[model samples]
Target: MDSDTFVYTTYIRTTPEELWKALTDPGLTRRYWGVAFETDWSPGAPMVWEEGGRRTADPGQVVLAAEPGRLLSYTWHTFTPAWADAVGLGHEVYEGLAAEPRSRVDFAIEPSGDTVRLTVTHGGLAPDGTIKELIGEGWPAIVSSLKSLLETGEELPEPPR
Candidate 1:
């Protein structure tokens, strides 16, 4: 990953409007994300989620926000309860990347007239072998599952052990 940016892109066989709803609507996201993404479409609004009793909401503000078909960008930190108080894995990681000291998450959507191209960029990941390995292999599966849900309205099977 020479890019220093972890990104995943997929072209869904659906309109931007449909995918927008799938991304922003908590009810619809649950159909694909398997958990509700609690957020209101307002700049600086907080976004968060809980799955299987685990909270995954990074503490930050919604920096870039556009409607329907453009982009959603936000500041993020890996601050789940599991990471709390864990040295060498908290704000230091975020600070090491840049001065902003927060992870950047981007959801960019491009309209192809017949489909929506979705790109997810998750920056500020720990530059470690295990973490990179997991994310590299896992994101594609998740994106493929997102495609399956958007196209066929079916959730992907549970992740393997």
Candidate 2:
């Protein structure tokens, strides 16, 4: 609700159930998000982030809320050395991000005239926060890729090296 919060919305030509699946299903998520989560979708359950054959999660990263096909909220990820190495981020920068207060992301899904509106609100971001900026930079591409994958049955081309 504040400037520290980042909200992204995209309308996918799909059902709310499908959009929810894309947000919660590990396999589906990995296809578009480049990351998969391990969680039971319970409010208090832990959400582990796995990607590129590396897994990283911490106590601070857990499901804040879950309602299938309607809403899902979870604490943001933990930055680890393996994650930094895999993502090409410097370890020091990773540490700096890790030191910041953990943020949370909430996904709200709604039916909208043959399409589903998916809104992602990422909050707890401090002004000029490193992790905030990182997530803000990342969400647009992530959301667009998700839309493409759901609509076209295929993901967009990989970024150039």
Cα misplacement distance, residue 129 of candidate 2 (Å): 1.0
Cα misplacement distance, residue 44 of candidate 2 (Å): 0.4
Candidate 2 accuracy as lDDT? 0.87
Q: Which stretches of candidate 1 lie over 4 Å from their true place?
A: 55-63, 82-101, 129-131
Tens digits of per-residue lDDT for model 1, 59-132: 56454565567887766534443543332346654343334335566788998768888998877665543344
Task: Indicate the worst ten consecutive residues by lDDT in candidate 2.
Answer: 152-161
**CA lDDT, every prediction?**
0.67, 0.87
TM-score list, all predictions? 0.73, 0.94
| lDDT digits (tens) for residues 97-137 of candidate 2 | 87888889999998999999899999988768787788877
Clashes of each: 0, 0
The number of residue pairs in model 1 that clash at the backbone is: 0
Candidate 2, residue 152: the lDDT equals: 98
